[model samples]
Target: MRFDIITLFPEMFAPFLASGVTRRAYASDQVAVRLWNPRDYAQGNYRRVDDRPFGGGPGMVMLVEPLQACLDAIRADRAEDPATQVPLVLFSPIGKTLDHPAVEQWAQSPGAVLLCGRYEGIDQRFIDTHVDAQISLGDFVLSGGEIAALALLDAVTRLQPGVLNDAGSHQLDSFNPSLDGLLDCPHYTRPEVWQGQEVPPVLMSGHHAQIERWRRDQSLQITARHRPELLAKARAAGRLDRKDEAVLAKIADGL
Candidate 1:
């Protein structure tokens, strides 16, 4: 999949694409990323890309012309017709909050054009004309959309086949379907004894069924304590079975 990012600070992504396990995805073009600087398409001695808002605003709005030109160049470069189905995505607070499901959708898609707004924001006219969808990280704000874009990239990249060393690792990730939409259980590594703590006996027992039961119980306990709402949703979806409810009841009773 190809992700074309429109940003004023293209340099910010250089290290990110090369520094992590996800780099394998980028390097192999499993998740090909290309950065475009709107300033490069701006027409001026200084190649400016932002301007003061029409009414009154503290920060400058990104210029429409430069962004339009940049987007045009990208479409032409990709030989994409004007009516092509590629989605132009803008990151903003007004959009849907990004999540695992969205990442999964994008993981299977051909690619998208990601607009990284800066300063106060992008020109509304440009967004209205070119953007097809918008996404937000959460309720908070950021200086730019680069971080949000990278988050989506990393999430999607790891879901690609062969990206992780363990093929089934992601299936056990929190919020995944395989875990019945529950948070993952705590993990313990290597030390038979650490400081005053010992690895859970069930983990050391090498009894697969018992170990699985222990982990599920731990996941239920942690999720009930930290994100009860998720547990409720899982129940509403009929994801929890009688055995799972019995485990949750045990945890609730201080077991």
Candidate 2:
């Protein structure tokens, strides 16, 4: 997968792309990430990418001409024609909220162009003409979109098939279908006892079926306590079978 980010502060993405598992993915050629700075496209002596808004806003809005030039150059390099399917996204507070399902969908796309608006934001005309979607990380306000863009990239990159040594690792994340969209069950390491808490005996019993049952039960309990909405949504979707209902019932009983 390829990710091209358009931003004035492209340096902000350096840490995530050069460190941790995502960096390993890049090193293994499992994914590609590139940053494009709009300022590079600016013409004239100042090479300014922002200007005072016509209506006079508190912060300068990113100028559209430079952004359009940058994006056009990027598309040209990729051999993308005018008729190509578009998936360029602009990060904005007013856009649709992003979630695990959204990340999954993006991971399946051939590639993406992420526009990280700065200062007050990008020019509205640029977004109207080029953006295919506007996505928000959540219902919070931030100074700029750089952080959100990194979060999005990390979420999708980890889903690539060879990104993780254990393919099943990403598969068992909180929203995975195998876990019925419940939060993951507790995980224990080598220590039989930690601090004062003992590893659940069922995990050490070497009984796969019993361990599976215990995990399912623990998942139900965790979801019921921390995210009942997930269970409710699962029930509403009619994805909960009798066994699932039984597990949830036991969870509710204990609560």
Candidate 3:
């Protein structure tokens, strides 16, 4: 898969591509990432890409012409590949909040054109005409969409085969269907005792069934305490079985 990102600060992505476990995906071209600077397409002595808003806004609005030109160049570059039907995604607060499912979809996709907006925002006209979808990290705002773009890239890249040291690691990740959309249970490392606290006895028992049961119960308790809505959603989707319900009921009774 290929990801073409349009950003004013392409330099910001340098360390990202070169560092981390996910770098394997980028290094092997399993998930090719190309950075495009909109300023390169801007027409001016200074190559400006933003201007004062028409309605007299507090911050400048990104210009459409430079963005359009950049997209045109990108499209022409990808025109050789008939199978490259990429979505133009813009990161914005108004867009759907990105989630595990969305990450999974991108992991399986051919690629996309990620537009990282600056200033107040991208021109609405450009968005209406060119953008295919919009995604948000959360309710909060950022100085630019570069961080969100990086988040998407990191999430998707980690899911690529061979990117992670363990092939099935992501399957056990929090919010995965394998865990019925529950947050993962607490993890323990080599030391059985830490800070004078012994490792949970079940983890040391070496009984596979008992270990699995303990993990599941911990996951259920953690999720119910921190994100009850997710547990409710799992129940609504029929993911929680009788045994799971019984455990949760015991937790509710403070057992």
Candidate 4:
């Protein structure tokens, strides 16, 4: 997969693309990333990209000309094809919140072009003409889209094939269906015994099937104690299988 990131601050992406699972993914040729600076498309001595709002607003609005030119150049390079669509996303607080499902969808796509808006925001005309979607990290706003871009890229790229060292690692993450939409059960290390507490007896047992059952039970138990809303959603979506229901039943009984 390939990701083209359009931003005013291309330098911000260097550390992100060079470390962790994303870096490994890029090194293995499982993924590709390129950054484009909108300022490069700007004309004049200052190479200015933003301008004061026409009617006068608090912060300067991003100029459409430079952004449009930059996007056009990108399309030209890719030789845009309708059948093989690539999503062009603009990060903004007004858009749909970024979540697991959205990340999953992006991981399956051929690639995406992300617009990292700065200053006040990009002109609506440029966004309307080129952007395929607008994604928000959460309800809060950020100074610029650079941080959000890095976040989204990291999140989606880690889910791509070969990105994870262990196949089952990300699968077991909270919100993943493998745990029936519950947060993962607690993890343990070689010590077996902690500061004062010993590992659960079930974990120390040599019964693989029973260990798996215990993990599932603990997942549901922890979810019920900390985030019953997650279990409720899973139930509504029919994500909880019969075995998961059994685990929940046992958890409830103990409570």
List the global CA lDDT of all models.
0.92, 0.86, 0.94, 0.85
| Model 2, residue 94: C-alpha shift (Å) | 1.6
**What is the lDDT, from 0 to 100, of the residue 125 in candidate 4?**
87
Tens-digit lDDT track for model 4 on 56-163? Answer: 869999999899888888878878886776879999988899877778888888888889998888898898888889999898989899899888888877787777
RMSD of 4: 2.1
Off by more than 4 A, model 1:
none
- For residues 140-205, what per-residue lDDT tens digits would candidate 3 score against the true structure? 999999999999999999999889999999999999999999999998877888889888999889
Q: Give the Å shift of residue 159 in candidate 3.
A: 0.7
RMSD of each: 1.2, 1.5, 1.4, 2.1
**Model 1: per-residue lDDT, tens digit, 37-89?**
99999998999999999999699999999999999989988887767657999
Q: After superposition, how far is residue 88 of candidate 4 from its true place, in Å?
A: 1.0
The list of candidate 2 runs beyond 4 A from truth reads none
What tens digits encode model 2's per-residue C-alpha lDDT throughout 137-210? 88999888898998898898889887777888987899887777789999999789889999999999999999
Q: Which ten contiguous residues of candidate 3 have the minimum total lDDT?
A: 76-85
Q: How far is candidate 2 from the true structure (C-alpha RMSD, Å)?
A: 1.5
209: Cα error in model 1, Å: 0.8
What's the true lDDT of residue 60 in model 2?
A: 89
